[model samples]
Target: MTSNAPDSVERADVVIVGSRCAGTAAAVPLVRAGHKVVVLDKARFPADTLSTHVLVPNGVSELKKMGALDRILALNPARSTHLRITDGDMVVCERYKPFDGIDYGICVPRNLQDECLVETAREAGADIREKCSVESVVWRGGRAVGVVYRDPDGEEREIHAKLVIGADGRRSRVAAEVDSWTPYRGSKNGRGFAFRYMDDPKAGTSQHEEMGVYRAERTVGLTLPSTPEGRVLAVWMCPAEDVSGFRMDPEAAWQQKLDGDPVMADRLAGAQNMGKVRSTADLSSYYRRSSGPGWALAGDAGHFKDPVTGNGMRDALKHGRLLGEAAAPRLHDPERLDAALAVWERGRDLDTLSTYHWGNRESRPDPVSDLVREVLRTFAGQEGPDLSDTFNRARPIEAIVSPTHLVKGLVAALRRPGADRKAIVKQALGELPLEWHGRRNRLLDGFRSTRPTKTERPDWTVGNAPGPPSYRPAADPAPVGADVPAVAA
Candidate 1:
């Protein structure tokens, strides 16, 4: 598409790039608050991604808050769950309950999920334009004033707005449009390696079902919910550069590793090749800040993690909600925009930072992979399924470091061989270090932050626009395009 014609001067309260989870979620909350929102995306809908397709419970909750939980459930993506951690011949499932009741997350194809959400934002009155690439961010007096984008018709156009948001994914063009963002350089998001297909029938499988992260000592495989014919599965990793072989022949690379490992190979049996056997270099990464003057970033644009935690979409949803709530007060007062975003940053920074580091930890297994698997399996029944979160959060490390608090743990270890009780505890404590304890959730003397969930009137809709944006680009040329300093306030 071209640029926005010189004749047209578009107006919006908020303009967002990327229309998946973060952009859509941000639009909904702002639309309810009566903001005129425009969501621009460089790609069309129903796009495929290197995703495991699982929505963690927290991811589900945020979608629920955005009024998408029921709709998502109705889509009937496979609902299978529980992590099944296998080490050699032993299989153990450890459940990590951040809250209650939900032991597993939901699984849906990335294409279907993104499409559903873009449509939802449309219903809520967001001017969603697909296949439109943003050229640059327009600035006024050194502050973000609007955006200059290449429209679907291959024309250039500018959409004036009170604020511009980088809802774009990890490698965001909007983020590049900002000055402070320059110092951040490139994106912190890692590369993602994944492949999916309908499960081959010959694996001697049970009824069609979706399983959450199934981790072995060296690799991880995930199954999405069952499709009409079968289930979708993907084996992915976020390795630190050295495991660079995946960028070449991913299929061969994956095969070599999976085939060498008996457990992972078992997970791949009867796996039919479906779509593109590719990798996404722009997996999620941690960002320095969330907002600046007249702009804020959400979802992968803000922060993302390796797929090991299976929380990218979940983080997007939660962070988007927070962004919406932050922008709410600013929508009316205008003067409070910066302040509001600062509050939102304060509310989310710690949690996301903690999650990213944890995700990095899970990207690759440690030296004692076999022993770790044994310990997890031995305690499987008592814990939930899937040790991705367990491993990522290093819950086992916490248990060992504080052995005095874990009754029966020594006995449980004693039942299994190659175990040294006190020595193991000492090793764990030494590895954990003392500084991290400061980040642990502490017993507050008073109360938690009382942030309201509903930042605006739910009855409002951003999708109420007369029609979707089909901005025609101009034949002529026009060039374009935040300090994230210490939170916005």
Candidate 2:
């Protein structure tokens, strides 16, 4: 916790930008391994940010491993052991199966959750500088060496380090400076999100201990019991085309959408709104080039998925910690550091590809088809793999709903009396292309690697250097189906 003099040049083994989930998670591991780690952020702790706010069991496990779980639990956030999902006329309610001996999910706001992580990193011996803004990276011999930043006192300073990591979120300044802002694979999201808090009188009741999800035509609603007794977070996701109407009168729109879902409407009948509605329509998903000489990207800085899956925070904590663990031992050797970063990047892509596609499918504006409803009904009645395992990352999502399982569900539905066999067959035929595409992506990504080829590395020579691309969000957001070209394999 020592501060350097104003305008002085400092040095460290690793310099991390952004001190929230990913940066702090990385700093804890590096500092505990005896590396001189410096973490910087423009905002002070206990600050609010847009978030899903739900931590699946695996994310809670990461916090426990980092020794921050006790502090988080002290906040007294609501704990959910049961999950209830309602899609059209189908319903599935089940208790979460334990993963690594942990069984419940908790919803704590970012302000409290992030502060706990920051304190944990600081306690592990990382120098964390709040209200510090990094302006650009310093380069020498075609490699990143450090960063130029403005400290809290409005004085400009510099810090040289053996490795620089970007944990800064989706419009990351670090990612821009390193020329890694352009995503290699990207797609526009079909859904937009709006959320707010409510005070539920039945908070401590047994029914309130369950997390509820209602999926209706062109919309999805979530009721997650959150922190501060009697408070719950209500989230609504609607088709992108509906965002304009929502932006015009948010309160009315929020109420109207919730009322459209009978199940969610009944649950919140007596609840009181705690705040004004908050929302965003910029929910595109992408994966940027994550690593290069002397530099790397962690968390949303390098990859992002639509929040529909509610897995963003979990991946951020897990991968950020893994990045530090992989790079700590190789920092002393320039070549080894770069190689290690490339390896980590590849592993992360391989791990998340399935969920990325799954999220896109879940958030689409299409109405739930009869075939899909039957599939879910079949899954609910059967004795098989626990679907909750997909959320906890204990098993891949495809394993739970494989092609074989889908066929079995369809066959069972056809055998039912009064079934419209002709219509079901037609709908199943229409879905084959999408189903095949998803499976093909998983198979191909398994054999591919993220290691850079000779031409992929930047040519940082004096005259050949390219200026950083403007990575800022546009003034008017793009439409839902905007064209974004994907890189060829």
Candidate 3:
């Protein structure tokens, strides 16, 4: 073990990597609690990344807690009270109900959102160093003690701390260095997305606050109102195989596709493209181990679901706050801190699993069955809080899309003139089923199973020393496991 004697090395109570929503959110609570916190990020602030900018009411609540909601609202983000979606000939407009007095969603761009969060953390006393990249973790006595990083000038430095946090996005370096294993990984949907900002005065109708989605046979179009008065975001998501033609001549391809779509064409008639079309193809989803002896992973560093559902920002904010709450009180005791982190990690998986599966089903390139269409139609026509709950994320997804509902919808579809019984039956039985999910997970475990490579393993786990004690809590924390599965593993 390295000596703890005073040296030129800097130190803190906690060292957080990645100063985006997740990292900044976690730092807020810890620093406010009087802990010496330092946040490191590879990029400078006020930067933007590829993202779906919708924030559901649940996420708005987190922003409220951090005192960033008011500042976000000042950015002129369009307030959305409902979601408008269409499938075939059916169109559903579901309104969002108020949650704790927050009745709407917002479309704050990442540039504004990330800046606000990092600034908030700074105000709360967190030392944020931008242009600093963490190269690896430093270990002492089988536990993570610090990190080795390159400063802005490319000078290597060591910073010691009791705990290290990974808030980096999907390809998190901290997670790799700690040997975090992915227990579940969702299959690719073979879909790609191209989006651009636009100056469309008439993009939205009915309400100033609503997300408009149009669905055709194999494509989906979205019109999201952004901050400025006449600005909006227009996106088209389609099969990966179909994206190449669109990429050939982006402007012509985008306009052609828009004009061809039954719904989107009319709404964007006079809209002028404000920026170059940005495209993304590889968007697979997965969940990684959240905590180890003295290290924890938060936000996308640990779990990422498809962006089709517009849940990425929400998940990052919610999980970051939960992690902060869980770890703040136990930072001084390794055993207790690890236990708390384990609970938070498990809860994150259980809470997000249903949505993860839902996104995969929704993003598939295959056409929806007649039964599925009817199910959506039926839910849209219903008059009650259920529809609101569905759109606002107040209810568990299973409650909205249950097996019983599918069976009923299947029966209805069977009566349709051109219903393909085989396809509908196959979809009803196979798509989004829990059993199917379990099977895929088992299959992935086999394909992904292997001993950690030297570069990916921790110091203790990398060397001959027996691997760090099983982080799986020796005694399950009763409070944390009340509703989660036996083990997230």
Candidate 4:
């Protein structure tokens, strides 16, 4: 694993750093296309990490496309078909309908989920190198062509590739080395998360599966079933100031908080704490520069939004695959590849910005305003868009919160008998400010001209590849160092 001789230099068509959802998802497409792909991860398999870990229907669909959804469900995850949200006095429950024969969200633990995706990539002919740390990006004349990594033995080796991908998490070393700056950084809310796992066999069944969100005063709690081990993740996202006290004695405090909510408390009345409590603070959302000369960023490495919306997994998995498909056709030419990646980056921004703003509002440490409460009351069975669509990102934000929709909703509220005109006025003022803030950013960003002028077919890169990527279906589908046709329209 030395670089002293040309023959000794480990080579691949694409070298992917980080083997979680993003890196593995990206590698699958290239490997299927018969490209030589090497995926490197610093961590060993079946390791745990902090994640909301709820896969809404949108996320499930992406896994389905990769043929991994069934495998995930085989782990006996609770299949949720409805979401029940309790916002102060108003209660709303909406059922989930099937999307392309798939319904329900699965909450697989990150450790098990990451293993499934990495194994999927291996099945498709990608070489997965675990416990390998990427020390630095290998740059040549301003373009990244490879990386310097340390294997598990702590021996340094150089890997050269036609393209290098940074699928690492939000704190991406690849992005840092490339100076990939953030164009927009969203506001940070004072909210922090404290989570714990429990054994709850009676959480719900598939036919009656449920996800519960309760917002009382300034505190919010989420309870969802996760993994085959009969574990459910109960999370409390409260003001940052309250976290230290909870951290002192998490189980006792968590139980106390749950006791305040009769419904959540009842569901967990007999459940036993399975592990120690974990917490995270200072959650800020932002989008980073996604692509440059020879390297492109995917997943959290490229862009990350708040986890409040639970769309991180979908974004990471879907966009990683899209990026790989986009680069497949133009991998040999840095110019075309960069252009395609630019297109992918733009699409990613457009798709996630609305959710990003929504997450900011959710993550805000301030008490849930009456105005926001009123809005949530409307997102129900009788009014507003389907809760699943709004929360799961099945539809764009424009569908739910357009100017026309807002005006109509306001008028409807004002017409109600015994309406508090003063409260209505305050609601409008409070909500519109954040809406305007998001609008201003979007407007400014729209005017910024970026990307190459030349346009090649971009749609084909989105899972529209010519055929099955690999020559075979199982492991080692292609011979070592196989080269397939360049993806083209």
Against the true structure, what is each candidate's TM-score? 0.75, 0.87, 0.86, 0.85
The collision pairs in model 3 are none
Model 3 over residues 1-489: C-alpha lDDT tens digits? 243635988989999999988998888888878899999999898989888687878788888887678777777777777778777778778777677688788887788888988888888899999999999988887788998899999998889988899998877888777766332333454567888887876745653466788887677888877766667788888876767766788888787777669688777777775688887765666556667778888988887666777887788888888888777878888877876777777677666765766666667776556767877766667434454465467766767766667667778777778778887777667654543453343333232222232111121211121333232333333321243223222
Error of 3 at 191 (Å): 1.3
Model 4 C-alpha lDDT per residue in residues 422-482, reported as the tens digit of each score? 8888878877767765655444445222321111111111111121121221221111223
Q: Using lDDT, give the best candidate's number.
A: 2
Candidate 3, superposed: residue stretches over 4 Å from native:
1-6, 181-184, 203-208, 382-391, 432-489
**What lDDT does the true structure give each of the candidates?**
0.58, 0.76, 0.72, 0.71
Best model number under TM-score: 2
Candidate 4 error regions (>4 Å): 1-7, 181-184, 204-208, 259-263, 382-385, 403-420, 439-444, 447-489
* lDDT value, residue 339 of candidate 2: 69
Candidate 3 to truth, TM: 0.86
lDDT of 1 by residue, 258-376 (tens): 76566556655666755555565444334434565677778877555667666678778777877887796576454477656655655565555445544554543343343344445
Go through the candidates in order and give the C-alpha RMSD of each one to the true structure.
10.4, 7.9, 6.6, 9.8
Model 1 compared with the native: what TM-score?
A: 0.75
Off by over 4 Å in 2: 1-8, 381-385, 412-423, 446-489
lDDT of 2 by residue, 457-482 (tens): 12211112231222322321111122
RMSD of 1: 10.4
